[model samples]
Target: MTTAREVLDRCDALAACSDAPERLDRAHLTPALARAHGLVAGWMAEAGLRTWRDQAGNLCGRTEGREPGLPALLLGSHLDTVPDAGRYDGMLGVLLGIAVAQRLRDEVPTWPCALEVVGFTDEEGARFGTALMGSRALAGTWDDAWWDLRDASGTTVAQAARDFGLDPGLVGTAARRPQDLVAYLEAHIEQGPLLEAADRSLGVVTTIAGARRFLVEVVGEARHAGGTPYPRRRDALVGAAEAIVLVERTVRGSDAIATVGRIEVEPGAVNVIPGRAVFTVDLRAATDDARDAMRDTLLAGIAQVCAARGLGMRVTDLYEAPATPCADRLRDALRAGVVATGDAAPLDVWSRAGHDGMAVSAVTDVGMLFVRCHDGISHHPAEAVREVDVAAALDAFTAAVRTVGATAGSGATVRSGATVGSGA
Candidate 1:
């Protein structure tokens, strides 16, 4: 009974909880995130589910199945966003989940698996620069080194967690066992032009691209900008600029997707010769082998660029995720969902963009439903989706849930002895 209009309004409501008054800029472990959670938790509770904030900062809610304490078939998406992001990318999926909760609030005979939704805290990594922290933690893939990672304001993850009322020592307790999750279903915007060009309302995701991120540093001696002669000076910014050109030129017409999104230079004085330049690289490809091969060539090219510039070079890896293929069983359910929406056959597409499903795949099967956005615009202010398309997507998503739920043993939690969502 939840209309698409309500979902859009809710997204706008969440968008208002941003750090900047001028633009939408919500990030992880911030006051803005706390406010967003407070709003969403209420929505989840009103939809007939018990809600809680997981130790990893993910907002979660669930309702029991035919009996109490069944393993969960998960739904929902991240709530974080990039700077000045379009509201629908992650927000729509979450609001849709709440709609689904409303749709099934009074189940005549509750399905085998419990229904749970999670609004992940940090999928964009816009704040910490390391994406999928929330999903990875839920998948039991926590990295201790992340505690040392700092934000632009030099706030450590531990301090931020404490500031957000989370205990660092107990962060590990957020992990959910493999047996505790039956599956994870994420409905998201296509974030590309293909769906729109094809004139489709929805599509099925076959795989998610593998991505590797690195911070490459070019070091040079700092000297007086005016006094230092051209031959004597080693300008890091210049060196980094040259290397970044190589990054673009190398992947210009290739199947791989590469970007140098962020760069920073040392020496605050504008007149001072730059001593160090650190730039972030986000490299992704359809397959792991292709991605790695392209990375090897690209890094070698960067190293050569630094050597030619007579600069010290260091490459520090920020993150890496292997290409994740959708589970066939889950994919089938999604396909069936799309078919039920009057699409005789669903267009199967591989995602060029990264998703939290990549991290969650380790814990349970993962599948995605991609709704077409206006011209595939995302991460920008103009991102958009149609109400009719959303309504269709909702119908398909509900059918997919039933399709998977039907496979569960009669009155059983998991097919095996697995216990789904046994976490607090």
Candidate 2:
């Protein structure tokens, strides 16, 4: 079998200058990410796999098995990254799939099913404001509404699709029939410090956290900061401060988490009292019920703070995705794989910040494996993962692949269909 270090090295070489702003900004499949996609496709073809681009621009490489009609096992992760994102985020999964293909190249005959490695486009949503665009299409979840989504330059997703040589009208062809895919698995970095703090080598995610987003706007009368008496001032910033505290309290009261990630004040001048404030609230929990409770608590707290401050407020939901449970069989397979390597560590715990696996889980039996990242920092240029730990994760993943491949139709893929999108 190919080593994890080798796999990682290959991916690094391919994406060495990808999406680098100086080389054609990689965000939103800008020319840079598209070039990276082309490079990956070239590598896949060289590896002796049949490669093609789906209607949604998902680059797929297939390794055929003895049974052409059997459902294929899908391995995927997005290739696009946030602005200046680290290389390992989505590239590792695709490279690992390539390693799997290399392993089977000269092996004996009679494979049970096919292997498909997909490099999904636009998972970061950094530029487009819509995450998992590629996976959503594969899951048959994208609609015309997404066509209107524009980036900072007012470039629509539809326009981007055309710019990259993909047919915008054929986007629906990316969706697969249930019978076409047996299961899906993704390997990614933990993107957090939990695994490193726990001294673990692998993290078999139990549930991808449920998330709810809200845009809060607070309005108040503007006044001159120097001319207006402090008592007479109607400051939106002051009201926003109170709302932030309430948001903290609301999340702290339950087993949920919340953050006011972005905030803006109108007439942002030191000499003027703020007239309005806008902020986004991101809340996450292990279940929909917990998430709903947290949302309600936050809303009530915001209303109370607004009423006390005599400020007008409005709350709008951007989007909400319920919690998704990882497949039990797949989880067990991963555990076994880790144990087989003799470096198996106890399962690490943490909520995922963002991942494409969440979207795939909505439609099929999907599992995730996370390798510990250095200092738990991600979405930055300095993000790093230990090479040795990554190798261990690869071993664990390879074992899981073998187990799933060997036990193709033993009901493992069937028992967990309900858990894919079930919030529990």
| Candidate topping lDDT | 1
What lDDT does each candidate get?
A: 0.87, 0.78
The residue ranges of model 2 lying beyond 4 angstroms of the native Cα positions read: 19-25, 104-109, 252-254, 343-345, 348-350, 415-424
lDDT of 2: 0.78
What RMSD does each model have against the real structure?
4.3, 3.1
Which digits, one per residue and each the tens of the lDDT, describe model 1 over residues 1-424? 8888888889889999898889999999999999999999999998988999988899999988887766688898999899999999898999898888878888613677678899998899988878889998898898989888999999988899999999989888889877777888899999999889988899999889998989999998889999999999888999999999999999987888899999989995889999999999999988899889998998899889888878999989988889988777778888998999899989998899988899888877788999999988999999999988898899999888877764554433232335532221
What TM-scores do the predictions have? Answer: 0.84, 0.91
lDDT for position 185 in model 1: 88
